[model samples]
Target: MTQTATRDDDVAAGPRASAERQGDVRLSLQGVDAFYGQIQALRGVSLEVRQGEIVTLLGSNGAGKSTTLKTISGLVRARQGDVCLEGESIARLPAHQIARRGVVHVPEGRRVLRGLTVKENLELGAFTLKDNALRRQRLEEVYALFPILHERRHQDGSLLSGGQQQMLAMGRALMHGPNVMLLDEPSMGLAPKLVTEIMRIIKRLNEAGTTILLVEQNARLALRLAHYAYVIENGEIRMQGDAAAMREDASVVKAYLGLGD
Candidate 1:
C-alpha cells in the first residue's frame, strides 16, 4: 500500500494521523477536498500534525499547497472530508473562528499592512482578544521572538526590509497564541541567509510548543527541517515518509530535492 493509504511502518509517523500513537493530534485533515469555483484544488488530501511536530507539505506552485493551508484556516470551504482540531470538527468553520480556535494561517506573501506600524500590525493579530492587558503581553512575547520587530515597532511596516517584514508577519501570527500554524512558502523571495534564519526561527517556535504545518517549495530545506513530510502533485498526494528517508530516496532526489543529475 502507498504510504498515504497507511502510515510509514518503517519510521514513526508522529501523532497527527496515527491512531496508535500517544497524545493528541493538533490538526487532522482527512479526505479533505477544496475547490475554487469548481476547480478542484485538493484531491482527498489527508495528513496530520501531532502536538509539537514540524510536518511539511511539499509541492510545486499550483499544486494545492496554499489551498491546503487556506482550507485548514477556513478561508476556503472544504467540499468533502473533515478537519478536526483535538478531535473536534472544524472543516466548515469560518476563517476567523478557526484562527480564534488557535489555527493561524500565515499566507505565502508577507501581507503586512503597509500603512500600519509594526506594533499596529501585530495588534491586529490579536483581534480576537478583548483584554488590553493580555494583548499587550502577547505583543511583547512576539517582539521577543522577533527582536527586529521591536527595533522597528514605530516604523511603518512597509518601510522594513523584506526579512524584517517577514518577521513582522510571523510576529503578527504569534499574537493569536496559535496552537497550530499553517505557514506557506516562508522561504520565498528571501536571501539564502535570511531563509536559513527564518527556518531556524520556525524550529524554535516548534520547540516552544507550536505545531507547524509547513507548505514549502524548497525541497532541500523542507526535507531537512521536517520530521515527517507529504509530497503532493496536481492536488493529490504522491509520496510520504520520514523526512530524512524521503530526502534519500532516488526518485525524491531527482524530482524534488535538487540532487538529480
Candidate 2:
C-alpha cells in the first residue's frame, strides 16, 4: 500500500539528542518541477538541507519522494527550477557529474550489483575519484562503520542477506564521502533490529557532517530521526515543520500514524 503521510515521535530523532542547530545550507531545491514524459510528478517542490542535519520528506508512494531524489542525483532531469549544492547550480548536470559533486544517492531496493564482490561494488562508487589514497581511506572508513562488510568483503554482494546488502549499498555510497546523501527508504524490508541498526547508522552519518535528505515510509521513524520534515501529497508539499512540532500534530496521527477514526 502507498503509505499515508504523517509525522510522529519527533523527540530529537535519535536517543540522547536535543534541538539541532541548523548550519549553512548544503543542498537547496528551489521551485523544482519534474515530469515523466507528459505526466507531471513534482510541482514547484522546494526544500533545503543544511550541514549536519537530517531533513526528511514524508509522503505516500507516487507522491514524488523518489523522483525528488532522482532529480537531485541527476538520474531524472529537472524541467524547471534549480538544484544547488554549496550555492552552485546543478539542476541540468548528468548523474555522474552530480555524484562527482558529492551528492550521492542510495536508491531503493539496495541496488547492489549481484555479480560483483562486495569490495568491487564499493570500488565502483569511487569511479569519479582519481586519487588512490582517497579511495583507500574511504574504503577503510566504510569497513570501520560496517564490520560485517569487512568480514565478507570478498563475497558477492548478492550472497549476503537483506540487512547485509543494505549495509553494502550504504557503504558503497560512502566511498565518495558525500556532502549530501539522498536516501530513499533506508529502513524498508528489514527486521525490527535491523531497522534500528540502520537508523542509528543514519544518525551517525548525520553527526559526522553528511547532510541527509531522506524519503521514508515509516513516518514515526522518519520524524524520530529528522530535525525538520516536509509532507507531500499528489506531488505537492502539504505541510512542513520542525520534527518536534510534527509529532503532536493531529493531522499526522490521523493520516500517517493510523489513528484515523
The segments of candidate 2 whose C-alpha lies over 4 angstroms from its true place after superposition are 1-12, 15-21, 256-261
Per-residue lDDT for 88 in model 1? Answer: 97
lDDT of 2 by residue, 17-91 (tens): 245545888999999999999999999998888777888898777888999999999988899989999999999
lDDT of 1 by residue, 108-170 (tens): 888989799999999999988999999999988988889889988999999888888889989
* Model 1 TM-score relative to the real fold: 0.89
Best by TM-score: 2
Error of 1 at 18 (Å): 12
Error of 1 at 92 (Å): 1.2
- lDDT for model 1, on a 0 to 1 scale? 0.81
How far off is model 2, as Cα RMSD?
Answer: 3.1
**What Cα-based lDDT does every candidate model obtain?**
0.81, 0.84
